[model samples]
Target: MEWLMYVSVAIIAIAFAVLVFYIIQTLLSLKKTMENISHTVDGMKSQVDEISKESTQLLHKTNELTEDLQYKSNTLNSVFHAAEDLGHSFQKLNGSLRKVSETVSKQADDNAEDVAKAVKWGSVVMSFWQKWKTEKTTKQADPGKEAN
Candidate 1:
């Protein structure tokens, strides 16, 4: 009976030791896993910070681009307005030229007969002046004798 009691105690002690070893091993594994997770979380935090900075820069650049586009669009609007004004001016000039041309045409049409009559009167006066000059020269050249 004394040997049986010692064997039972020994068995119980061995079982308890095995259980404690396994518990310690489990705790160590859990600690290692927790450390890995902490490192991963830190890495993720750094990546997030970098991404946040990049996104902020991207947003600022986008705003600047939007402002530049708006300014260029405004400038283009003025150019369009200038083009429209030039077109209007050209149209007005064309209209004025057309009106002047039409007036000249109308005046020429109204004065065509008067112009022809004036040309005919000019020709008749020139013929009379030429004939008078020739007669006077002939009389002067033959002053000593009567001219036939």
Candidate 2:
């Protein structure tokens, strides 16, 4: 009976030691996993910071581009306005030319009959003058002829 009791006590002690050893090993492994997680978090934090800085720079560049585009658009707007003004001026010039052409046409139409009458009168006067010159030449050639 004394030998059996001693053997049972030794077996219980051995089992307790084994349990303790396995617990220690699990704790060590958990510690290593925690360290790796901490390092990964640090790396991720640095990468996030870099990304933030780049994002800020990109935002600033985008703003600059937007401002430049706005300025150019304003300048282009002025050019378009100038072109519109020029188009208006051309339209006014065309309208004035049209009015002048219509007025000249109207005056020509009004004077057409007067111009024809003047041409007829000029022809009649030219015929009388030619007849008078011919008579004068005939009288000069024949000095003793009558004045008829």
Candidate 3:
């Protein structure tokens, strides 16, 4: 029995020693993890700040681009208006040209009948002249040749 009591005490002491050793090791590992986390947080802070600066620069550029685009669009709009005005002017010119063509056609039509009447009178006069010339030449050709 005395030997048994000694063995039991030895086992309990060994278990306690093992528990204390493991607890100390776990605490040391936890401290190392905390230190690593702190270093990582510091690095993240610097990266975030750099990203913020870049974001600000990008925003400024975007604003400038927007203003430039607005100005260009306004200029394009004015150009479009000018083109539209030109189209209207050309349409008016075309209308005037059409009107002039119609007037010239009407004037030519009005003169056509008078020209035809003049041509008819000229033909009648030409026939009379031809008859008179034939009679005069026959009378003057030989005086007794019985008509040329």
Candidate 4:
């Protein structure tokens, strides 16, 4: 009986020792894994911070580009309007020029016969004036000259 009691006590002691050893090993492993997880989480946080800063800069750049584009678009719109106005002015000038050209052409057509008659009369009058002047000058040189 005493031997049985001693053996039972020894067995119980061995089991408790094994259980304590495994518990300590598991706890240490869990602690190490937790530390590794903490380090990984800290690295991820730093990367996230860098990404946020880049994102903010990108947003600012995008805003600046948008504003610049708007300004250029406005300038282009005014230029387009100016071009349209220029086209209208050209159209009006062309119409006025055509009217003046048509009037000139019509006047020329109506006066063609009158212009010809006037030129013929002018030539006849010039010849008569030349003959009269020569005859008077000769008469003045001689005392009495009859222009036959």
Candidate 5:
């Protein structure tokens, strides 16, 4: 009876030792997993910081581009306004030219009858002068007839 009790006590002690050893190994494995997680978190933090810096640069570039576009649009607006002004000037000039052309046409039409009457009078005067000169030449050559 005493020997059996000793053997039973030894068996319980061995089982307890085995349990403690497995628990320690499990704890070690958990510690290693925690360390890996910490390293991964550090790496992610660095990547996040790099991404933040790059995003900041990108934002600055976008703002610069926006300003440049605004400036160019303003310049284009001025050019469009100039073109509109030029178009208006041309329209006014064309209107003035049309009025002048109409006035000239009206004047020509009004003077047409007067011009015809003046031409007839000038023709009559020239014919009379030519007849008088011819008679004078004939009288001078004949010397017997007096020219009245």
Candidate 6:
């Protein structure tokens, strides 16, 4: 009976040792897995920070572009306004010219008959002067014949 009791005690001790060894192995594996997870999180955090910085810079550039476009648009607006003013000035000048031309045309039409009578009087006066000059020259050439 003493030998059987010793054998049973030794068997129980061996089983307990086996269970403790397996537990230690499992804890070591869990530790390694946790360390890998920590490293992956750190890498992800750095990448996210880089992305945030780039986004901020991109936003600033976009704002500058918007301001430049606004300035150009304002400048173009002035040019368009100046062109419109010039067009109006041209229109006014054209209207004045048209009025002056119409007045001149009307006056010419009203005085057509008067202009024709003046031309006829000028032609008659020129004819009389030529005839007097020719007679004086003929009389000077022949003094005796001129007395008649």
lDDT of 3 by residue, 45-144 (tens): 9999999999999999999999999999999999999999999999999999999999999998999999899999999999999999998898888688
How high a TM-score does candidate 3 get? 0.70
Clash pairs (backbone) in predicted model 2? none
**Candidate 5 runs further than 4 Å off:** 1-12, 112-148
Q: Candidate 1 vs candidate 4: which has greater lDDT?
A: 1
lDDT score, residue 119, model 1?
A: 97
lDDT of all predictions:
0.98, 0.98, 0.97, 0.97, 0.97, 0.94
Candidate 5 TM-score to native: 0.64
Residue lDDT tens for model 6, 19-79: 8899889999999999999999999999999999999999999999999999999999999
TM-score of each: 0.65, 0.70, 0.70, 0.64, 0.64, 0.59
When sorted by TM-score, best at the front, the candidate numbers are 2, 3, 1, 5, 4, 6
Per-residue error (Å), model 2, residue 12:
3.1
Model 6 lDDT-worst window of ten: 139-148
- Model 4 clash pairs are none
lDDT of 5 at 123: 99
RMSD of 1: 4.7
**Candidate 4 accuracy as lDDT:** 0.97
User: Which stretch of 10 consecutive residues in model 2 shows the poorest summed lDDT?
Assistant: 139-148
